[model samples]
Target: MPYVVTRSCCADASCVLACPVNCIHPAPGEPGFGTAEMLYVDPRTCVDCGACTTACPVDALKPHTKLGEGELPFLELNAGYYRRNPHADRTPMYVVPRRRSVPEGELSVAVVGAGPAGMFAADELLRHPGVSVTVHDRLPTPYGLARAGVAPDHQDTKQVTRLFGAIESQPGFRYRLGVEVGTDLTHADLLAEHHAVLYAVGAATDRRLGIEGEDLRGSVSATDFVGWYNGHPDRAHDDHPLDTERAVVIGNGNVALDVARILTADPGTLARTDISDRALAALRAGRVREVVLLGRRGPAQAAFTVPELLALSALKDVDVLVEGWPDGLDPDTSEKTRLLADLAARTPAGGRRRIVLRFLTSPVRLTGDTSVRALEITPTELYEDEDGTVRARPTGGDTQTLETGLVLRSVGYRARPVPGLPFDEASATVPHEHGRVGPGVYVAGWIKRGPTGFIGTNKTCAQETVASLLDDFAAGRLTGPARVVRTRTQALDLDAWRAIDRAERAAGEAQGRPRVKFTDAESLLGAARAARTART
Candidate 1:
């Protein structure tokens, strides 16, 4: 049976390494690898060695025969991408070279943020002998978005945590959780104690709609909504009033699809998922029946990934409808555009819940007195510039008002400035050239390049930053660790995290779920302490 990539694929691309025939589309170094929504196994070329199944961090690879009814759609979903070009050129499987160890003396690096970037950096740094890595994150949780931002229903994507766990289990690797670098310890402290410090803190804030009435009670960002559902301690208690019968989401990105899916999904269906208990309860009590995802551009410019759109379309009782198709559609298309056209061609089944995908519309204002009551949108025109770039221009001829109680802006994400780091206001990123911010200081991931690309994108990003740091060390630009006293911070290490992980899994076991997460610092830290005591 051919193996298929499923909804939970984190896009980490580990499966590509195990594929002997390079059957997976968009493997690293390939043309579209960076932007691909998910790596696809070419069924036509798949040897069914089951190598990818073992290599996948999220266990996203599954044989056709063993897939559940809900998962069977992915088999076709994977195949459909290749249907257009079945005989696409294939290359030898790319092999990541083993990193050579640092020469001269002992190397100790501090990586801030335990997200994909930081974890991958640590893994790369550890490949060198006589090197040790210490990771730090402000939150009690180890992984950032991988733990708190991924949709709970995507259990497979969440499995990338296992890869991180493996990295953490490596010798000379440690993490300090619940410790804010700038607040708890100065940047100089880390610089003093380590040869270098790599900042991998990802883009944390969402781009705002910046429209009138945006501050209305029901106006929320997709970032918070994702965080809330994934049991992010900071947003778990948010009062996301899902009291609206119909909601308007501004943007056509994957995040917008995620929000629409969460809003319209049956709460009973979410119960078995790893969604937060409070979020589950709120969703169950919610009356939301319809969601309209608005895109300021045409279907050709829609920002959502094809896989996400496929998942949205596959929703059992939810209708996926599209509006605003241009009379003469452009012949030029991408995989995303082709899938969107297919969705537009299909008729809705008149399901109880609906997700309407509207194109060439931009939300001009949020209309309401107390809470969001409606969204005023202006129609847009798409034009190609001399450079062949498609741009959206607002047209005044038509305006529409959507009676939506809730409005979610899912435009994009911005990296917040770290207190002690040099930042570029224009890009909302740390000032860096090839990941090196300064001597003995570097950056990786979204904070370094602004939020773009998939999770595996960070691995390449981290590799670049590490290469720079290693070059600096080899050049003797970084002399040595400063001779300064380091203050002790009450932080949790990998063991503490494992303890908390076990406790959460134990708690989830009784609930018949994957894991019941601790959504607060107190409970999470307390569990860690208890685990530490037990270990002693």
Candidate 2:
């Protein structure tokens, strides 16, 4: 049997290079690689040598026979890709891009944001012999979404940080944590110290639903809700009320599924994960039993990827149900629709906790007093345009009221305007031509493209930005700094970050869980300082 790519696939394409038979479809340069949900292994050609498994950062590859009940679906998912989209005339091996020659004299780059995009860009730049990178972030810790945005239970997904750690170990890489680029050190200041400044600052704000009573006390954005559970320092102190029997989440994206899963998952199971202590306690004490996810369109137009939906179906002791599924919808339309059709056919296991996948619905208003008490939702009708595009509009029928105390808005995310950077209001992104904003100024990640694609999609995005920066440097468009720039903010260095890491691990070891994250700036800094004092 061949190896199968599972849900945890990060789409970094590292495994694509390791396959001796070149069985992985949609290699880096191939079509759909950037937007693919997960890379699939061609079972027919796979030698089962496990080379791809060794190269995978997230351990997303598994032997076919060793697959668990939950992972068995992926076997067909991988093979189905080959059946639907065969790659017969493709190159036998991936053609590696020619390495660009390093420009004369040493080159320095300032990468703003220690997230995946910034780290990937830094890694790309450091490939050149004479390149050096200084990464800066507002947080004391690094790995923005990987650490704080990924759900705690998905430990496999979190393993990508190990790759980031390897990038940090590179000789020319350094971090200036706790320093905000626009505020603490201006873009001009960085330009004076480095040859170029690359902004990987991701979308920082959640898109709001323009409805009545959205500002009620019990209502919150899924971004903040995920942050609260994931130990994000900014949301560490946030209070989420879960004292109701049913909680309503508005939206059908992957983040919506994440918050719903976390809300309904058994507290005993969550305790073993790296969830914030406060969130775990609140969940244990809360009375929430059912989470209803509202989708404005039908199953065909659902925004979440198939992998996330599969994970939702596999949750232990939780019943996944489909509500308000439209009539005449074909079950064979797509994998997601087929799965939903199967879910709609199943009998509920009568589990105490359940997640309702409600379709063809839109929240017209959030009915509440000072706090969220109920939600008024309207049915929606989906229509197809001449261009084959599907959209939803209110049906103008009777509205139903759902009594719930908590309402999480998971509509989407938008990029906030960075100080001193030109932003396009319509797209909520920085204005740039192929990642170039101006001379010595560039952008990557969600800030470059709008918030779309998977985590590894940023790799190709960063590679393009780095290529542009290198081309400018080779053409003498970049000028060396006139003077050295200095900042008075006390920034955390590599050693300090390592110290915090050690402390978190040690504390988690005592609790028989993964590392207990420091959810506040003071505790993180204190751990670093204590370690520094001990060395002295």
Against the hidden reference, what TM-scores do the models get? 0.93, 0.98
**lDDT of all predictions:** 0.84, 0.89
Candidate 2 residue pairs in clash (backbone atoms < 3 Å): none
Model 1: clashing residue pairs? Answer: 8-157
Deviation of model 1 at 518, angstroms = 1.2
Per residue, candidate 2 scores C-alpha lDDT tens digits across 188-298 of 899899889999999989999999999999999999999999999999889988899999999999999999899988898889899999999999999999999999999
| Best candidate, lDDT | 2
* Candidate that would win on TM-score: 2
